[model samples]
Target: MSMQLNRKYITIVFTVAIIAFPIIIGFFMLNKVVDPEEIMITKTEVSPELITIQGGFGDSISKYHGYNISHHDHSLFIQIKGSKFPIRGDKDFNISFTNTYGDIAEIYLVGQDNAKRKIWPQP
Candidate 1:
């Protein structure tokens, strides 16, 4: 009889742990993800007719005295020009220019990983 009672307690403990472990892990994961720092917005000026970007929507510089805003990411990357660079966390550098249409430019910075993107400044 005592063995049965002990078995019941063990089963109850196991059940509670099985249900609660994931909840606890999820809570910690959420906490870790919710603490991201704010993204920085920097602005610079570039000629609208300086460069032409050639992939994925075909962007280019179309405005004079336009803006070259970017969120520079220094993550591990290569510019496909025999160059490899590190794009660290919180160090992504994607640029977007301001023209008549909006924050889209013709000049693109193609990465070695086949990520073709406009070289405009971030907002």
Candidate 2:
């Protein structure tokens, strides 16, 4: 009788752990910071007058607004505006800046969460 009780207890504990471990791990992973390279750039339009880049975070539950563009020498610093919310679906963005610098060798997309990624001249 004592052996049966101990076995039943152990089995119950193992079942609970199996069920709860994934839930705990998933919760932590959801809150983890997103890497910059994960930011996907889907489309880019480069012209002599304007530079337009369109992209979004797939499977991200964050709300993002317009971009803030700053040009320095041969690089363009583009930062997305907005914050993460308890929402669903992906967020897309359209950013355009004047092509006063002529030719851009590099482009960086900075997120509101401080994630920075290079989107142009992909290597």
**Local distance difference test, per candidate?**
0.34, 0.69
Question: Model 2: how far is 45 from its true place, Å?
Answer: 2.4
Question: Which residue ranges in model 2 land beyond 4 Å of their true spot?
Answer: 1-35, 86-90, 111-115
Error of 1 at 24 (Å): 0.1
Instruction: Tell me each candidate's TM-score.
Output: 0.30, 0.56
Candidate 2 local lDDT, 58-86, one digit each (tens): 55665444456778888887765443544
lDDT of 1 by residue, 65-110 (tens): 1122232332111131210112212232333423333333333343
Off by over 4 Å in 1: 33-123
Provide the lowest-lDDT 10-residue window in model 2: 81-90
Residue pair clashes in candidate 2: none
**What are the per-model numbers of colliding residue pairs?**
29, 0
Candidate 2 CA-lDDT value: 0.69
